[model samples]
Target: MTLSVALGPDTQESTQTGTVTSTDVLTAPDIPWNLVIWNDPVNLMSYVAYVFRSYFGYSEAKANKLMLEVHKKGRSIVAHGSKEQVEQHAVAMHGYGLWATVEKATGGGDGSGSGKGKGKRG
Candidate 1:
């Protein structure tokens, strides 16, 4: 009796027929996560911006930008890094009485649904 095997178009089979390696098996690391602060009834916008400036050391313009993103879009990514980093940011934001959470950043781009709003107290 005889047996035969055929490899796919992209594969070359050795006569010895050892294991095959797939290029697709390897992938880049997961995208870094982010700590997102959402606009909420409980926190003031000025406080949120101040927290960004004080804790994250963001410039006034940058802090105001992120704060505006949160207010208008309903949410904005306040920090980015590994899960531990994001969690730390979230905790610190919470300490400041802001609503924050960690989430995986969308693939290769900022995810949709962030709104736009001018800076205003609360």
Candidate 2:
């Protein structure tokens, strides 16, 4: 599978081949986003871990680690994707009674925190 686009004049044509990934979306190029879940008193750690497992299909260990990060570090980035998708994830998190937000993913700048855990922006 391949995708090629010609963006009018003054721009070099781009070609994408093989395993087309989400980040390959030509709309925004290299700028991806993340879904950050904040720790809240109401949701139990067990429930938080459950959310990660059920919603994200994360392994028990990975989910527990992320849950621990939220509990100890105040927050954790649970997933990453485009603005629309991450925003939907945030909303779903809210529906599950967790605090979540979507922000532009930074490569170690703009104070968005480190990109770690099982983010889906690959």
Candidate 3:
């Protein structure tokens, strides 16, 4: 007696055969998420910089840069990491009386619809 077997065109045969795999695993992007701080009438500029330095241990120069970005641009991405870490940063900033949020770094669109012109100080 004889037996016959057939395999599909997409099937790959190991030495043992009978294994099936249709797709390859995909990897997520390596970019980190960002924790952003937004300028508000409530928090002083110096306080924002101080929070950056104290919470993230950022250097004075870097903290100042972020502060300036907040002041001029109405928002600045103060930290980058996983979603959990970014959320932690946002919470800490809120505790410090600063307005903060998190977002995927690659998506540059600010979810806040306040508009760029809205934040500009006269």
Candidate 4:
């Protein structure tokens, strides 16, 4: 069964009346959080890539890609994990003299979700 409400012309909202049967609860793009790294002028592009490789264990190509992203986009996502883990990564980045922060991901999620780690250098 379903119930619906219309607030505008030819528009409607619907509520389903039934038990869920194991359908996916959320879409892929709605991850809940991320750790975003901002870029600065102090770190060399090569050094930044090296950091990605050494700290995050990213492959040379992947590290370079993320480093390039940090260079071009001024930020990048380095790792993904629980909030606690990402927070630790952020603090670690700080310890490494990198700029880093954790934030809610760009889209909404079901509250139980993953987050990415962030790192930056200037």
Candidate 5:
């Protein structure tokens, strides 16, 4: 008895196969995530706005608007992306002395649909 096998485009086949079944790997798409900046007593309002501007490349008006939201709402979703992306942003925010976190986006949309935008200087 002799056996032969063939590989075809990410699949395997056997010449003496009893059952040739192909299983397609269904990979889940990357879920959307949110980078939330929380209100903190230590950081000044201006500093937060500055971070938004310098780091996120947000316009002065937009930065101030988001900063105001963080101040009043106690928290604001500043950026949206994949989980890893948002996590990196969170770490960067921490380095800037800003309170930040990452959360799975609601409804899989770009966060809460409020203050929905992302800007990177680079």
Candidate 6:
């Protein structure tokens, strides 16, 4: 898919000590976010895998792996990028009739539930 983003010109304000304060630097757009796919009753497992393969261009093995993650763990972080990028991905996933959302990347857990027990099927 072709994506076009029009970025505005850079602007920086001078501080009292002759230091520059750029909003771009302060509000860094590079901060990462995650596209989370939630498991649900409506969609079939194979369909979820197909969406992953077709939309994200994931390999068959990778697509199945992520799909299973969603299946067993209740959710999975399928993709990560800047906030806007993941938000766009979430929108695309929604378009495909999948339950999806975006959240700031915490760099901690793998965005899965504890594997100690099986998850309830809806």
Report the number of clashing residue pairs per model.
Answer: 4, 0, 0, 4, 0, 0
Model 2 lDDT tens row, 7-112: 1111111111222254333455445576778777888999999998898777788789789878877777777655777898888999998999876765543343
Best by TM-score: 2
* Candidate 4 vs candidate 5, lDDT winner: 5
In candidate 3, list every pair of residues with a backbone clash.
Answer: none
> What's the lDDT for candidate 2?
0.63
**Clash pairs, model 4 backbone:** 33-105, 42-122, 43-122, 79-117
Over the stretch 40-83, how does candidate 5's per-residue lDDT look in tens digits? 78899999999988888777887897798788777777776567
For residues 1-122, write the lDDT of model 1, one tens digit per residue. 11111111111111122222232332333234657777787688888899988888777887887788778767776666556767888888888889888866443343331211112111
How many backbone collisions does model 6 have? 0
RMSD values for the candidates in order, in angstroms, are 20.2, 12.7, 22.1, 15.6, 20.2, 16.2
lDDT of each: 0.59, 0.63, 0.57, 0.55, 0.62, 0.63
> Candidate 5 overall Cα lDDT vs. reference?
0.62
| lDDT-based ranking | 2, 6, 5, 1, 3, 4
Stretch of 10 with least lDDT, candidate 3:
1-10
Query: What is the lDDT for 63 in model 3?
Result: 80
lDDT winner: 2
Candidates ranked by TM-score: 2, 6, 5, 3, 1, 4
Clashing pairs in 1: 72-115, 72-116, 73-114, 73-115
**Count of backbone collisions in candidate 4:** 4
Which runs of model 4 end up more than 4 angstroms from their true locations? 1-32, 106-122
Per-residue error (Å), model 2, residue 12: 30
Candidate 3 Cα RMSD after full superposition onto the native fold (Å)? 22.1
* Candidate 5 residue runs with Cα over 4 Å from true position: 1-27, 107-122
Instruction: Please say which candidate is ahead in lDDT: 1 or 2.
Output: 2
